[model samples]
Target: MPRYKLTIEYDGTPYAGWQRQAGLPSVQGVVETAIARFCSAEVTITTAGRTDAGVHASAQTVHVDLERDWPADKVRDALNAHLSQAGEAVSVLTAERVAQDFDARFSALRRHYLYRILNRRSPAALDARRVWWVPRPLDAEKMHEAAQRLIGYHDFTTFRATQCQAKSPLRSLDVLDVTRHGEMIEIRASARSFLHNQIRSFAGSLAEVGFGRWTADDLQAALEARDRARCGMVAPPYGLYLIGVDYA
Candidate 1:
């Protein structure tokens, strides 16, 4: 068997998510279907991350093994052609033969996520589904300042999902920065692995600081409390994107 690695990009608006579920449309399901069409065999693909419903990915990585040896370029082109024929929004950006030991998820060193907020008096028109429309004036600088409290190793219990299956709440968040580009406020988060809704929880809590409702001390307090009840709004999935994954 030959193993191949793939870099993928997708518009996640129409899919249930990156993971396949019975009778549900998913990025994985569509890509697997495309592969089956091109190769007439079932192959299990492993992804670096399982993005939630409505979340997008720009450089998602995955690996798969196939029965027949195929050129990397042919694999990319054939799968893409099949996906296009079916009108699926997923795309295989690159494909290369990799060693069998390269497990996409386990081998990932870090994952980067971007959350976008539209800070204006009116709703987003062009990038409606791509950004979170916040019709109030936001202080991106304050959000950045408050986000610093979340950097480094900590128990992110307040920012994690109640149903998160991770054994521990401790996660080393390498980066959490907020910046503004005109009317758009961007929040970037990087970590080895993230708890469910972790970034979204941060976004929601930080937005309070941006809106003058919470102080930097309050953000710190939330973290130290280590209670889910202290967490604020969870940003919507559409505003979140798995920008890239790193391996080392």
Candidate 2:
């Protein structure tokens, strides 16, 4: 068997999430279907990270094993052709052969996420499904200050989703930066792994700070409290994007 690594990008607005459900559409399901169409085999792919419903990905990584090795470009173009024919908002950005020992998920070194907020009284004219619209003025500086408190290892129970299956809440966050670009407020988070909904949780809480409802000290206190009930809010999934993944 030969293994190939693929980089994928998708508009996550139409699927239930990255994982395949029996009847629901998913990124994984569509890609697998496209692969079967290309090679007529029931193939499975290992994903580096799985985004939730409505969460987009710009550089998602996955690897699949095929019984026979095909040209990498053919695999990319063929699957993309099938996906396009099906009207799926997904694309195979690139595909290449990799060592058999490479495991997409386990071999990941970092994962990056970006959340966008359309900040202004005027609503999103074109990017309605890709950004969160906030009429209230947001102080990006406050959000950034609050975000810094979340760096390093901590028990992120306040931000972790109740339904999250992660065994522990302890994780190290490498970067959490808040910035603004004209009418957009961008929040970027990078980590080895995140508790489910953690970034959204942070965004919601940080929004409070940005809106002047909370301060940096308040955000820090919420972190120390480690209580889910104390969590401010979970930002909408549409505003979230899996920006990239890194591997050694």
Which candidate has the top score in lDDT?
A: 2
Task: List per-prediction Cα lDDT, in the order shown.
Answer: 0.93, 0.95
Q: Summarize candidate 2's per-residue lDDT along 165-220 as a digit string, tens digits.
A: 99999999999999999999999999999999999999999999999999899999
Mind giving the per-residue lDDT tens digits that candidate 1 earns over 1-248?
A: 88999999998899999998999999999999999888999878999999889999888999999888899999999999999999998999999998888888999999999999999999989997899999988899999999999999999999999999899999999999999999999999999999999999999999999999999999999999999999989989989999899987
lDDT of 1: 0.93
Cα deviation at 95, candidate 2, in Å, is: 0.3
RMSD of 2: 0.7
Q: Compared to the true structure, candidate 2 yields what TM-score?
A: 0.99
Q: Give the Å error, residue 69, model 2.
A: 0.9
RMSD of 1: 0.8
* Local lDDT at 92 for model 1: 95
Q: Which pairs clash inside model 2?
A: none
Each candidate structure's TM-score, on Cα atoms with residue i matched to residue i, is 0.98, 0.99
TM-score of predicted structure 1: 0.98
Off by over 4 Å in 2: none
